[model samples]
Target: MPDSQIKFLVVDDIRENMVALEALLRRDGLQIDFAGSAAEALELMLVNDYALAFLDVQMPETDGYELAELMRGAERTRNIPIIFVTAADRDERRHFRGYEAGAVDYIFKPLDPVVLRSKAAVFFRIGQQARELECQRDEMRVLAHHRDIAISRLKAHADNSPLALIECDRNLTLRSWSKGAERMFGRSAEAMLGQRIAQSGWLDAEAAGILQTWVDGGTSAQRHSAEIDARRADGQTISCEVFGSTLCDLNDGNLSLSLQLLDVTERRRAEEVRSLLIGELNHRIKNTLANVQAIARQTLRQADSLAGFEQGFVGRLQALARTHSILSDMTWSSASLDQLIDEQIRAGTLDAARLLRKGPTVQLTPENALRLALSLHELGTNAAKYGALSVPGGEIRLTWTYNDELLVLRWEERGGPEVHPPARTGFGTTLIRASAGCEDDGVSVDWSASGVIWTITLSVGVAQPNQPDQERLIEPAKIESGRPELDGSRVLVIEDEPLVALDIRYELTAAGAGKVDIARSIGQALEAIRAAEIDVALLDGNLSGERVDEVANALRGRKIPFCFVSGYGRQHLPQGFQDAPIIEKPFRADALLPVIHELIRR
Candidate 1:
């Protein structure tokens, strides 16, 4: 109803007093109704709703108090606000009696017009608000009725649809089954109804238990979906996708579930085949790229002329091929560290009596196997050229120990020509130092007069007997100029090549990124992005064959600044990422550090 139609009732035996009261409460949106006596006021109240009532204290036969008592006794007028209008002097007892008669307030004789009108206006606005709330409740009831109709229509449709539909009670007993369900499961409703769904042989024990758990734990609003192997009446298993939801039975108000099943055995089989093929392809491509990189590095290092480059390149390729052969035998999972050292160092050596090796059994991951194989090759080549192996009487001892989560290797040479530090570090020296491990001061070389003694320390994650509980060793601190301290910033590196990933992690830590996370696949990268509190990210433009655009977009959406570290150039990137900085592959610390600092500052 419109606000303009609201009514106010006035009661008094004196006609003049009623007129004065009506005029006092007069307003544009108010409908004022007057009654000459208590009986007349009660009659009008029986048929109409009032925002408020003004009742005189004195009356002919039935006083205002008596009329109010009758109104209170009935449900219809009990909550109507009453204001007592009186000519009597202000007496405490009379006021108390007025309250007992359900007067919400009182107005004295010769009432102040301003006070009376203001108080009545307050009740009028409150009545309007109450009416609006009631209207809203009515609209909601209508919507609920329509929703019930829709559910009924859905039930009818399910009975005739091709997909199987079954309903079960709270205890998982079959309450209803459609014709589609009977055909799909090869059982009639008469045989299944009122029996536990598990007894019907439609679902195996494990599948049934999983469904039951969801039903018992889930609320009426939750809809759960699962793929399970279901058994039919003939004892044949088929993969099916089940959609289940909890609902209330309208007739009994008991909890029940509605389940729909669709066959998907063929689709699942096809997807598995496709996933296996893709995984194998990505593995082969990445391995081939790593081999090419290794060959290029060695070729450039040993090449003084075209002939020298060809000869060195072929030797390095053969060495890399041998390592790959061993890795392939192990399905590229891991290789024994001792086997790797022997294969790489003792390949073409005739005087093997000069070399001594000692170490416990340790397995190296495929990436580590390749890197260490190259480093050992470089060290052996140097020794053959200028160090111990070049002399017939020279001797070299390789001893290693694992303790406190640190793997320490000492390469000591004696009985050779006097040694001195090189004027400039060569690529072989750099590769050996990096592979052996260098954090602050992990790699050290003693250029004694007798020979060179190299001590290298690496942090190993796997635990062994007598090893320290800590998974990593504490690194010594180093202060480097032009490298800003990240002050414990969290960094995420998304690279698929394991060696490159390790390099990025090491550099990030050395530059003061307290936490460095590695993600080798797109799925793992996305998971890390969500789970970590990342301050900056170093993203590889591509992960295997998939581009890192999705990860970059997610970082952008979160306002996390990141730069791409890829082999590709700017034009090769996706359209929207042209402006994002791209740190080219074979990253240098000088180029990478500034970009990282700028990203964090921005």
Candidate 2:
């Protein structure tokens, strides 16, 4: 309520005295209630909250001291300030009695208006301050009520959440555990609370140390998150993503820790599987591209014209692509040898019905599948162009049998133009002979007057069941006379993917680069730049979500040339780096070597 609404009481038997008291206390915003007798004053005091009271000491029936005593006895009026007014002369004994009766001051009349007003003003201000204190107290109570409700709601939510919530003290002693924690850890709050986190044997030493550091630092605002292994009640280790933050205890204002743990065992396992698959994919892609490169080089070496080279290269790539598709459909594990032969024959011949094929159910590994598919494609192409399939009634009999774990396959042609062995070795011939193990006398070609008979006997080990064996046909080229030479030059490679980074390191090392340094992120790259004297740098455009601009700037400041290698386009590069050479991903040795040589020369 507004201060102006505050009321004061005045009691006296004489009308003149009551008027005098009211007038003396009168001021703007001052409310006065007049009562002539003690009984009447009691009634007014009961109904209205009075700031101060004036009682006449000599009233009939009940005197000022008696009325003051009555007001003091009541709960509501006990705290109200009282001043006694009397016409009789002041005596020490009467003053003591007045004070004993709860009178704050005794006034002897005829009263001095100045002294009375001064004392009344003092009481008025005191009453206003008291009311304000009461109002503030009420507001505090309301705010505290709301805070309690909010805390209760949060506790309810935390209890029901899937993430475990655990609160610990500075000593890493568990203080509170949510229901979610109990469910996640398979331990009850009663069992875990007040136990040292380390003693519980759930968190590993490293994880425990991390939590200890956070607690020791008293970093309430800073959040720390990490993936760690935590042992459950059943002693099974599970992967958990833990988020730690500091919280202040409302009761004691002491620093404590709140840890939220999310069980990510499945997620971590899935990520491991995905990473393995990605590594496998990278290896496969590298191998496939290398194969394509070899095919192009070999095809180009024997092509009579550019058109011939294009035709041969495209046909080889198509054959590789089709084989890849089939392997992909089978999850890259194994493919049916008979199915592979049929598909290749159908692709090359419109009269596929005329072709004879016989084979047992045989599954070929990815490596063997790809190589065998290419060989079969080459054979079919040859038959269609110059051998049996060139004539309408021509017949190509392909048969295979497995004995003593050896696969014997024969491609015999008949009823077509006379055939002769090629005058010069071609890519098709090389691929077929190499794949069939002709170097080991595993394959033979006999040119007869009727047709060409090519027979191959390979151990079943050549067609590995599920595992893709390393190719024996081609090996990655190393630094040679024609390749770019870095003999004594230092090179820095910045890439996040481990496999890609390793590949870059291998390539640089093979090119005779000395002291090749690899950094998986921008921070590491910057550190490497500071420590090493780099001649040239190959930086992935994105390093773990951070752009390599800072590293690039550092390299530029050092007058060291750097190139960007990324799966993204040049447009995705940071501004000012567009001028830098960008080699798109899946780059070959020929493409990468030239860039490196140019950068080193610059």
Candidate 3:
């Protein structure tokens, strides 16, 4: 029934009695139904709810007591309040029988309206309160269902999160481990729960100690953020950035640490790589600066005036710049040999008819390409000044060949002025020999009567640090007559970096050294020491990736004077040459030549 309606049922064998009671008890919000017989009342009771039922005690086929017995027996109608109505005197035995049949009270036939309304009002209020309670119970059930769904979603989100999430109790025992944590640490939740975090073998001893210190240094609610070195199950080192906060559980106000760990190992490694690349770039730049310095000095030496100096220096610088541009296009990796030749020809403005290029395909390493480009520029400068290019209808031929293990290149001038060796070796000849590596027979120049011919043999393939291309041909020039420091002296320049070696060779040649040999590796330096009488040597403390200690030891054994030319500190040099003369790189010819002069004098 509606909450605003209070229903009451009244039954009698006489219609007048029921009608009189309904008229007496009826009011707003109260609904009264009249039934003529006990059977009609029983049928009405089964289908509709009633706050109170009033039945006559005396009836033809059934009495109020009998109807009450039936309502008491039924589960659906048993709880309806019953009030027996009769037109007889009160008796103890009758009252007992009415009470036994589930009657709350009995009303006489000429009913009092005041007493009836008071009794009925109590039951009506009780029924309304029951309906209110039922509605509240249903609302509570819906709220509980919604709460369960929210908890399920929150749990799923935590478990599937990409960052590792872990919760631990006040005692540092793991209480919750998400699937993300499990995957990151390679440990299952079953194994981790109840395990003390610091002792769980997840963090290294030092990291665990640091964390413990953090916890003990502050209150339970303190937050922590730091990057820590962690370890996987396989014992490999990993880096993680940890963010931690102490959370108080709402239910019991219990404190626990919640941590989110982010993996940063790869990012850390990339930073290290960037640092190394920057260092290497700094080293290469230093080498280039040294080359420029060498060029300026040598150009000054050969120039007849300021104009000649500017022309020569700027041309060499531009050639260096052009070579760098070409290498930069390939990311400084390698350059095509023929492509380099063609570029140099175009840059030098060489006559296409007078010069022939015949070469198989070859790739030169970045350093080799640059060195050869500058060397070729020097050759062109000389040829234009005195060789084939100086005369009309003069001709030049260039060719190259490779035999898988070695590469050879040749430069020949067929028609020009009668070729003859100069009294003193020029910078061009010195650079060609210096950059050609220190191997014996690596480079040679033949001054034929007709013109000049140059041949360069380079070892290529696997063992070389980078691709091959070295050596050059130019005007024949022997050592210049000079002061006693280096007249007719034979020297060894043991260095790995080609550009630095080239500068050293130029300096040595200008100092009147008759022959300056170059060695780029340990074995090559050792072989050079054993192959010829090296009056003095310049030994790089480190050649390629190895210490050139063997070369130093050989020089010491031969009683040949040599100095350590390196960028390393004295402490980093090889064993037992502490007293040897040393010159750091980015060194000048003025600073370097005196040391060799002293070594030769000694």
**Per-model tally of clashing residue pairs:** 0, 0, 2
| Model 3 Cα lDDT, one tens digit per residue, 1-602 | 35457788988888888788878887778788889888899899888888889888888888888888989999988988899887774998989988998999888857888888788788878867766677788898898899999989988887888788887777778888888888887889998899887788888677766666655554544679889987777787789999888666789876667788988899999999999889988998999999999989987897789978866776677667767767766777787776566656655435565777675667787777777777677777788889999989888888877776677878888779999998888777876765456666788999898989988777752122344544333322222223345897999999999999998998789778999999999888888888798899998878889977778889999999889887765777887887787776545455578778888877
What is the clash tally of candidate 2?
0
RMSD value for candidate 2: 14.0
lDDT string for model 2 (282-366, tens) is 9998998899899999999999999788767767776777677677678887887765765565344324565776666667777
Question: What TM-score would each prediction reach against the true structure?
Answer: 0.36, 0.56, 0.59
List RMSD in Å for every model shown. 23.7, 14.0, 20.4
Candidate models: Cα lDDT each: 0.77, 0.81, 0.79
* Ten contiguous residues minimizing lDDT sum, candidate 1: 470-479
Which sections of candidate 2 miss by over 4 Å?
Answer: 11-17, 27-30, 35-48, 52-126, 149-167, 178-188, 210-228, 234-282, 297-310, 328-331, 336-350, 353-363, 395-430, 433-602
Model 3 off-target regions past 4 Å?
1-142, 214-222, 250-253, 305-307, 326-339, 345-365, 389-409, 437-443, 456-602
Ranking by lDDT: 2, 3, 1
